[model samples]
Target chain A: MHISYNQKEVLKGINLSVEKGEVVSFIGPSGTGKTTLLKCINYLEKPQQGEIQIGDLHLNYQSLSKQDILKLRRKTAMVFQMFNIFKHKTVIQNVMDAQIAVQKKSKNEAYAMSLKQLENVGLKDKINEYPSRLSGGQLQRVGIARGLALEPELILFDEPTSALDPELVEEVLKVIEDVAKSGMTTLLVTHEMDFAKRISDKVVFMENGHIVEVGTPEQIFEKSVNVRTRQFLKKIYAEQDQQKLNIKGG
Target chain B: MTLETGMQELLMEFLKTLPINIIIIILSAALGLLFAVLLTFVRLKRIPVISQLADLYVSFARSVPGLILLFIAYFGIPKVLPLIGLGTYDISPMHAAIISMGFYHSGYISEVFRPAYLAVEKSQHEAADSLGYTPMQKFFRIILPQMVPVALPGYGNALVYLIHDTSLIFAIGIVDIMGTAELSIARSYGTNQILIYFIIALMFSAMCFTTDGLVRKLEKRVAIR
Candidate 1:
């Protein structure tokens, strides 16, 4: 996929493929188009040039119709960093809204499906609470429940835990790890290197709007052949170590 | 006459015309809200020439005095209608009052509406889109419920201002509360003049209070989200 904003390229001729049910994680510094690439897949950000094939749905960005974009989005769901669940809706309604709106499920059917998914995300007790009342972890769980209720063929996590308090990050990561292990095809953009390393079937290292390296976790984290990938890992690991030491000192 | 008797007499006269005041307020508020939603839609969508025109209308409505708008609707519309070959049309004081009040206050309400709608975070739209919600579904299901609560405080103020602005209708000779009070004062040769005016002020204040209370109740209910 090639994406540009205001004549400046954001994703430069990127090509990658994910097998069904594989968990792929995209890692990079800010502004490297990891989130943009995830958005492009769901047609949230329209690429200037590229073809996206998800399931049986394929769209070339140049000729993509409005209907084509909607069709493409229908097959996938995105969990945002801020957990953009509808604040006006209760936890269950946040999950049920898409089920009823997109899938056209009856109230009873949506309720049943939403309840199950909410439970899957460990939000059964908070089903009636609004997003405002829940902690960050709980809100992201609702975000996950919203996506999972749709039963989408693929799920995109755009730094799902990026906005959380450090203490709250674990709960969200745990829910996401559960989803990944359930064999859902997932693409995640995250700064959580260890979480990405442990859960991703494949890890992609991106920088300067290009993929610098693509490899398994061990290959990328332990023995990266690319200098850029190795350098990024060393810096990130050092930061993580500093944070751990700070936590211990505090 | 005793102050008690004078007060009773003035209150009776005021009550007779209270319904007219109430009717003008309700009808004009409905009209203002309709136009406000339309204006907000145009401004938000940036609908070309019409949006620019809406911008002009909002600016005109806000910048000009309510009394001037009342005069224009009363004196201008009847003349303008004939000039446009719509034939002779007599716009009564009540109709003119409603038109002017509605149009003038829509400017204020649109300012409220546009900001409230914009205040709904952009990420909500993206979330809805990712779920494959059609535009209409996204608006009614997601945007509107959220937008209305945010819009309520300003909308309530607009309604209160609408209530206050209706007093300008008496300038055009409508027999509303103010008009009736003034008429009574003239008939009595200024007897109990201060008392009558004070009673009229009380009536307007009561209406404003009720409106604010109702809006607050509504705010609480919708804010349950």
Candidate 2:
């Protein structure tokens, strides 16, 4: 779908669709509107110019009203670049707060759901611990578990691993990869190119607020039609590939 | 027998005025809480002129000392209220004292909250909004609960200030513990300086020690996440 912001088109008349159980990766340089695009899709920031339909929910700018957007958000979850776990609560409490408060799930039911999600993210042991007690990777997993607790239809990841330490990125990426394989419809904004190539069914290359290339993993990574896509990929992948070749040569 | 007579006089004098003294403390505390809440709300809303005025009130009250504030409110309000025909109202020293103590200390409580409100991660607000929490839910469920641990420390200090500052109410003719003690000692002992000091210190220490313990326990229990 097309998305625009402030009347100066960001997703200028773009078009795409995700089949159920497809994992899509949106890769681009910073400030190229990757995060804004995710916000628009989730109805956090209303898109002035296009339609956003998640599952059966139809949302235009009109549906961006407070109550309507909230209803829509219940169906869609977005994990932010920064882990937004409540600092005043334990990891489990953070997961249970919304469940018990808004969803009105009983404490017993909420605790059960919270435990299942935390277990899925491998943070079951840290349930009673506060966010400050966790490492960057651990916190991100808790954040992932928080979004998962809602059992959202579609999950949006906005640069989930970008904020992590280099060594910690793998753990977060592995969790995302597992979710992607679970056949949950996913849209991820990521700098981890190998991760995108490994798990994404479709990869959309965005540049200058528009999609320059959109295709399956094989089509986009191996065979490309656009010169800009080729150049961008070369610049992004050059260093890592060079180091790999040097190691092989030795 | 002479000492016993002094104790009887103290109790009688205190009981005679007890009704008004309690009223003054309660009503003034309610008023102080109201102003404190208003000042905090105004500061949160970023009302430039009002926040500045609040800051001025707090600084002046804390600087001059609680006793001085009591003196000014008691003597000065009578003069100023005349223009408002509040002049007809007899502003008692106790009334002035209660007003000064509650308001003067509220300023410090508001300052304690400022940093805490800022310390809340911006992302928590965003997540709550994304989850579709209404304005009220966003506040009571999310914001205010988080703010509790931060505000408790300040609230503890304010309570202690409220208790100690009650002594100033004696100056306004409220026959409280301090006032009754002073009266009984004046009549019975005539001029027993050492006994008076010991009695005053021992009585105040009990209250102080208890309040301090409560504050310490609350701080440990409410440790922030």
Candidate 3:
């Protein structure tokens, strides 16, 4: 895949794939194309070049029709970094909107599906509340529940925890962990190294618009051969250690 | 005419013309809103020639004086229509006021609508798309509803301006509130001009204050939090 903005390349000829029921995490510094790659999978960023295959469907960016895009999107769901729950809707309505509008489900069916998904995310008590009324963690969970309501074949998480207050991050990560354990295929872009290492089946490291290394968590975290990967991990580990020391001292 | 008789006449005239003033205000505002939606959609879509045409229309409408536009519609259109083989068009003052004001107000309202729609974050569009919403569904369900609260203040202002501009219809000989007041003053040999004008001013102030209060109530109700 190749993506550019205003003639400046953002994703440079990258290739990666996820297996069925596997969780893959993309980790990189800001502006390194981690989020862009996830968006490209759903054609949200519309890479100027390359083809993407999600299961049986193939999408070539140049020739894909609007119908093809919609068909591909129907099979996938994305949880945004900002928890883009519709502000005008209550938690349950946000979850139910796509079911009724896209799946053409009856109101009763959509309501049941929404209730089940919201319950799965432990938001059974928040069904009537608007996004403005929910905390950041709860809002992200609502976003996750909305994603799950679609019953998509794949889900994408674009820095889902980056926008949350530090104290609120755990609840959202716990919900994600549960979703991963349920064996749904997921692609996540995350800054939480510990969570990524704990949950990801495969870890991919990217730098400067290119994928520098791909391996198992054990290989990437403990035994990486690539010099760039080692340097990146060393920096992140040092920051994490400093954070732990600060928390203990304070 | 005595001050007592002049005051009575002015009150009666106000009561008689109240419905016409309301009809003009409501009709122009409703039609203006419809035109604004069309203009905003065209500009947002960025269709080649049509979008440029919409831009030109808005610019011209905003810059030209409303009275001039009314005169163009009232007098100039009839002269131009026959040349186009559409036959001569003879529009009443009421029709002229409604059409010109509708077109004129759309320019300002479109300015309000565009930014309010844009103010909704891009994330909203992305979420809707990833959820597989069709373009139409996304607009109606997601975009339009969020725009309502943001657009209300501007919409309320436009309605108030429309009410004030209804007085311009008197120039075309429409028997609206302002026109009735003017006719009463003329009949009373200008002796009642000061009293009649003061009553007219007070009537407008009352309408504006009522609208302002209603808009505040609505704003509180639809506030996002």
Candidate 4:
């Protein structure tokens, strides 16, 4: 798989194969093309070149029609960083829409499945409420629940906690941690370095549209061979450490 | 004027042509829907030079007075189709009124819908895409359902105008409730313009008010969240 913007490449000639229950975390600073890679997998941005395969289905950028692409998408759900639930719809309707409208599931079955997904995300109580009525963290949890109800084999998370308040980030992260444990192949694009260190089975570091470094948390954090990865880890952890020191010192 | 006699006479006269009025409004609205759908497809396709011309068509229809459209359709169309069916010279103004009202309001309704279709949030499209809905399903389900609530006010306004414009049916010679009232007043007093105008205005105002009232109720009921 590959993603290119202009002449610069992001995830150039990426040949990683993810098994079921494997979790891949992409860690990079802004403009590293991590989000673009995630969008390409979901068929949101049709890559100008490259092939992406999910299980038996071969997804070429050109060969897939709208029907084929939508069918592929139903199997792979992306949890947005912004928690992009339909604000006009209630939490229940947002979850149930894919089931009834796309899956052609019965209303009763869809409702039950939605409720179960909401319960799993610890959001069963807020099913009738609007997205605006929920906290940012709660909204993100509902977003996960909405994705879960789609029954995707591969779930994608686009920095679920990036937009949350510092205190609320933990709640959304915890829900994601639960989803990861459910044995679905999940690709997460995240800025939370510590969270990625703790949760992801494998982490890939990218810069300037290239996979600069990739390894286990220990390899990435403690034993990264690439100079860019080392510099990025230092810069990110240095800024975060300074913030914590300021709070503690004050 | 005794209450019972005057009211009964008025009711009898009004009831006599209410069916024709009902037919006119329903037919015009149906025609309006047909026009809106055709125009929407034309706009969506962006068909070469014809697509650019949709704007001109919408603008021209909207700018021309509905009364003049009625006059033109009743007078002009007959000339165009002189041999319409077995030398029948007396084509009903009812048909001309339907065509005119449908043409005039289609301009406004299409504009209502064009923006309504666009105003759907970006995330909604992404949501449909992620869920595996084809373009057709996305347009019909995700997009159009949301569009109804957005277009409600404009649609309601158009329907109300349809009622009011039924008054212009008199110019084309349709026997609408308004036309019947005007004819009654004219025959009674050899052109009592004041009474004729008052009766026609009051009758249509009442119909338009009730129709608008219903539209408001529907708007509230179907409002998104």
Candidate 5:
């Protein structure tokens, strides 16, 4: 598949697939089209040329009708970097909206399902509160709950922890780790190299709109053959070491 | 008549016309809000011809003076109706006032609403889409509620202006408060003109103040926090 914005290619001839129950993470530098690739999977940003197959649903961006696109989207849920809960809705309503609107569930059933999902994310006490009242960690947990409520075939996380404070990152990552352990198919675009190493079964390295390397986390982190992949990993590790040093010296 | 009786008679006349003024203000404001929503939707969707027409209507309504628009509605619409093969029809002054004020204020209301709708972050829409929400579902559930708090301040202002504009109905000879005041002044040979005008001013101010307080309370209730 290929994608472009304003005639500049953003994703070029990319071919990748995820097996059921596998956790895959894409890690790359900023402006490397990691988020764009995730968005294209659910047709949020239409690729100029691509065919996406998620389970039984197949969509060609060039020819798919509106209904087909909606069908494709139903198979996947996304957790945004900014934790974009509907501002006017309470936390439980955020989780319940899609179940009632898209899945056509009865209100009682949706309420029950949403409560369970919210409790799973450890937000049972915050159900009636609006997003503005929640902290960054709590908001992201609500976002995860909203994604999980649909019971989609795949869940996409787009840099979910990047917007959180350093102390709040662990709470969100722990929820994601639990989701990974549950054997759900997952695709993530993340900058948290250590978390990615721990949770992802497969890690993909992308640069300049191309997938530069794909392997097990150890293989990509410790034994990368490509010069660009090796350099990127080395730079990320050096920055982490510097931060640790600053903390120790302070 | 003596000064005391004259004052009493003027007060009675003002009270008689108050209900008509209130009715016109409420009806025009409701109609204006409906039209504003339609205009904002069209402009947001960027539907080619209809969007351009909405833009034209807003610009035309905003640029023309309110009294001129009232005259056009009262005198001009009857002439245009016949050309459309609908036979001549008399547009009552009350209907003319409502229609003209509704369309005129809708232009201002659309200006208020469009920006409020756009002010909602793009990520909200993307999240809704990724969740598989249909467009209608996204709008009502996600978009419209957020827009209300943002749009309320401007909507309140528009309502106040509508209240002031209702006095213009006297141009078409409707016996609203301003018209009734004019009639009372004429009957008194301009002896109580200053008092009548002063009372009308006070009534308008009171209505505006009441609207402002109500809107502020509503804003506090619906505030995002």
Candidate 6:
């Protein structure tokens, strides 16, 4: 895949694929097109050139049509960093929106499905509350539930916990960890090395729109041939150490 | 006559023409809102020549006086209607007034709509898109509901201005409240002119207050929680 914005390249000839039920995590620094890559999978940010295949559905971006875009979206669900849950809708309605809109479910069926998903995320008590009333963790949990409700073939998470407070990141990661354990094919763009190390079957290190390395989490985290990958992990570990020291001191 | 008696009598005279003024306001508001949505869509979509034309129309509508708009609609539609093959139907002053007011209201109301729509987070659209919502479904379901509360305050102010602008239709011979007030003054040869004008002012203020209040209440009702 190739993505150019205003004639400036964002993703340069990237090629990757996720096997069914495999948990793949793309870990990289910011501005490395991780989110852009996640968005491209669903055509949220149109890549100038690419071919994507999810199951039997294959599309070439250059000749894509409106119908193809919808088909592409239907096959995948995204959990955004900003939580982007509908502000105008109640918590359950937020989950029900796509079920009714794309899945063509009746209100009663959607209500039932959404309730089950919300319950899985432990937000059943907050079903009638609005997005504004929930904390960031709760909101992202709703976002996760909304995606999980669709039962999509692939689910994409674009730095799901990046916008969350440090203390709140664990709750969302716990829910995502549950999703990974459930054998759902998931692609995540995240900065949380430990979380990715714990849950991801394969960890991909990306930098400057290029994949620097791809291996099992142990291979990437412990013994990596790529100098860039080692340096990135070293920096991340240093930051983690600093945070731990600060916590102990305080 | 004392001020109280004069005001009481003139109030009835103004009330007699209230229904006509109300019709103009209601109908033109509906028409203006329709055009405002169309104009907002064109501008946001940026359709080549038509968007530019809409921009020019919005500017003209915003800058020109309602009195001049009334004059143009009064004289111009009769000429254009025949050219469009509707030659037999004559345009009345009331219809002309409504048309002009509708055009005038559209410009200001579109200003309200364009910004309010823009104020909604782009992520909202992306979220809707990621869910595979059709464009129409995204707009009507996701965007429009969110845009309404943001637009209400500005829309209410436009309505208040429209109420005042209705006074200009009297120049075109429409017997609205302002027109009737003028006629009564003329019939009395200008006696108690101050009292009659005061009553007219009182009526307009009351209408503006009600409109503004209703809009505020609605804003609270539909506001995102």
Higher-TM-score candidate of 1 and 4 = 1
TM-score of 3: 0.94
Model 2, A80-188: lDDT tens per residue? 8998777878899888888887788999999999999899889989999988989989999888888888888888898998888888999999899889998888999
DockQ of 2: 0.46
lDDT of 5 by residue, B152-191 (tens): 9988998898888887999899998999989888987998
lDDT computed for candidate 2: 0.77
Q: Rate residue B101 of model 5 by lDDT.
A: 94
What DockQ score does model 5 reach against the true complex? 0.84
Provide the fnat value for model 4, as a fraction from 0 to 1. 0.49
Computed on C-alphas against the true complex, the DockQ of each candidate is 0.75, 0.46, 0.84, 0.44, 0.84, 0.86
Residue A203 lDDT in candidate 5: 100
Tens digits of lDDT, candidate 6, B174-204: 8888888888889889996887788789889
The all-Cα superposition gives candidate 3 an RMSD in Å to the true structure of 2.6
| Residue A140 displacement in candidate 3 (angstroms) | 0.9
Docking class of predicted structure 5: high
User: Would candidate 3 be rated incorrect, acceptable, medium or high by CAPRI criteria?
Assistant: high
Q: B224 in model 2: Cα distance from truth in Å?
A: 3.2
Residues A15-75 of candidate 5 have per-residue lDDT tens digits of 8878899999999899998998899888888788767777767667788898987887898
Worst 10 residues of 5 chain B by lDDT: B1-10
Question: Which tens-of-lDDT digit does each residue in A51-103 have in candidate 6?
Answer: 88888887888889999999989888999999999999999999998899889
TM-score of each: 0.95, 0.80, 0.94, 0.88, 0.95, 0.95
Residue A94 error for model 2, in Å?
Answer: 2.3
Q: Which candidate is the best by lDDT?
A: 6
Best by DockQ: 6
What lDDT score belongs to each candidate, Candidate 1 first? 0.90, 0.77, 0.89, 0.81, 0.90, 0.91
Error of 5 at B197 (Å): 0.7
The TM-score obtained by model 1 is 0.95
